[model samples]
Target: MSLDTSTRGFGWRAVQFLTVLVYVFMFAPILVVIVLSFNASQFGGFPMTGFSLHWYAKLLENESVLRAFQTSLWVAIVTSIVCTALGILAAVALVRYEFPGKEWVNTILIAPALVPETVLGVGLLLLMRFAHQPRTMWLLVLGHIMLALPYVVLVVQARLIGVKRVYEEAAMSLGANRLQTFREITLPLIMPAIVASLLLVFTISFDNVTASMFWRPSGVETMPTEILSMLKISISPEINALGTLMIVVTVGLPLLGGGLARYLARSAR
Candidate 1:
């Protein structure tokens, strides 16, 4: 091997090593949580305190966690649906049509994602106070929608931009109405992006804490809020169990959704 070739090979190997190290650093905490979930000890630390499902059982039995989980689930579901619907429409319009101040409109639509979450949360709280609207699940839902909408719009819009107008125009030339063209051609073409947006919005809403912290009313707690309260009180193995379950669901659902999207895309082709 030449000297220059050996140096280049060493540089590439160093890059690969650093990439793996970065991944390990990011995932190590999650791996620890998964491992600690089965720890029999009440505390969440090392030393292999014997494997047991005690915390998982406790997580199941905890009414607070169950209620919080339910709240988070419904909020995420509603936020995803609303964001996806609005996002698709906004994305389609933004990508397909030109209007006066279109750039400004696009910026406005995506501004929330640029703003700090804490700032948004505080601003929402103030708006609620000024309006005399009580903090409630609906309020939280709206806040989450605002937070997730920009991401949904950006994702779906990027996909829409990549799509050719020829497909839609061809459908229209065949005497298909705008609605029919959209329903038959445009929607399917963007299904993967829509699916991705749904998963992203749902995950964001479900795992939200900063906004939920400001907007959650009395007697209402989302899973993230519940976890925060638990931490404030004291750490327990149950928290680890809860974290593990959340990690599984969050990672698993997106994978499933992505696979389904891929299958649908293939079928459409």
Candidate 2:
């Protein structure tokens, strides 16, 4: 009995320590940024002189940063919608039906997941140029979609498989057509995954630097692109403020969205 109790105690300690370590690993950088954002030093760093919101106020007035933020928002939003929809369709087709080269087709759909962003970005840029395409918002949108689609498809596909088609089958047996059955039953059931996938992809596109860097217009910028440009100059408190804002936003979105989704899901049931 003493041996068993000791072993259990050791296991609990191991789990607790692992949890603490994982959280520290994840949140240490964010904690530093949050603390440093308030530092009065013109440059973000330790041994703070004073705490002030000066940098955030300046950030509000920075036209270039604002423009880049706007550009990133629109691109991420459009990319999420387009890629999520395309992903859902492809995932549904692959999961719910069988056709020629099904495995091959699925593999191709998942190609971007493993492909290095730099290589994909360069290849896409070259492909667009060869097609005589202008560098535009649409091209950026397409690039983001390509980057995001694999993830969206994978998330939705996993949910689809887990949802137990028996429920959809029952809906069909009740005289619902294929389209109606899918619309009413399958879609609603997996809506959580769809929403999660959209948010995740949007965040990915919003935060992506290397790929978007290549595709973004020379003068135009996204938040990540702007951050890259700023890095070329030097670190500033304004950058820290921006980083703090993003950290808050990134943390808020999942919590808010996940709660809302859960509420709806429960209400639906």
Candidate 3:
């Protein structure tokens, strides 16, 4: 090979190495938490601090933690449902229609995803105060829906683009109305993307601390809040245990989901 070509190849290889290094750097903190979760030390740390499941055991009996978990779960669930439904509607309208101020509507729907959580939180808080609304779980759900809507709309829109328009028109020609065609045909075809987007938004809401913090009332707390308070007063080994369990569930379930989806697709074909 020419020297110039060899030099170019070396530069490309270096870029790949740097990209991998960046990924590793980003993941290192999470890896450390997973490692320290198994540590026998009262304080989670490095340097082979032994191994124990005592922290995990404590987590099982922690009522406050369990309550916070339940609250987070419900908030996420409610937010996911509301956001997904609204997002799907908005996306369908945006994709199908060409009307006045259509681009403006699309921009508003998508703007939330790009804004910082803190900015959204503060803005929501101010809006609530101006409208005389309380900082409650319902408000939290509303904010989360707003936050998750953009993601849901974006994902569903992309999936919708892949669907053939003729399928719906065919259904319509066969005496099926718009509602019937959508319920029977369009929804099922884009179901995978909807499900995936819902799960992702649910996870985002459950794991959120910033937005929750801004919107929460004095007496209420979520899992992330509980974790943060625990860390501030005293670093608990139980946090590591919680972190480890989350890692297993979030990381492992997605892997399992992909495999199951593949298996189902194969079976269908």
- The true-versus-predicted C-alpha distance at residue 52 of model 2, in Å, is 1.1
Q: Candidate 3 local accuracy as lDDT?
A: 0.85
Please write out the lDDT profile of model 3 over residues 1-269, one tens digit for every residue: 45665557777889999999999999998888888888888876666578888889999999988988889889998998888999899889988778999888988988988899999999999998899977878888988888889899998999889888999999999999999999988888777777777787888888889888998777788989989988888767789899888778777766776676566435533
Write the residue-wise lDDT of candidate 2 on 227-254 in tens digits.
Answer: 8888789888888899999888888998
Output the better candidate (1/3) by lDDT.
1
Q: Judge candidate 1 at residue 76 and give its lDDT.
A: 96
Q: Residue 91 error for model 1, in Å?
A: 0.5
TM, every model: 0.95, 0.92, 0.90
What ranges in model 2 sit over 4 Å off?
A: 1-5, 8-22
Off by over 4 Å in 1: 1-9
lDDT scores for all predictions?
0.92, 0.89, 0.85
* Total colliding residue pairs, candidate 1: 0
Per-model clash counts, in order, read 0, 0, 0
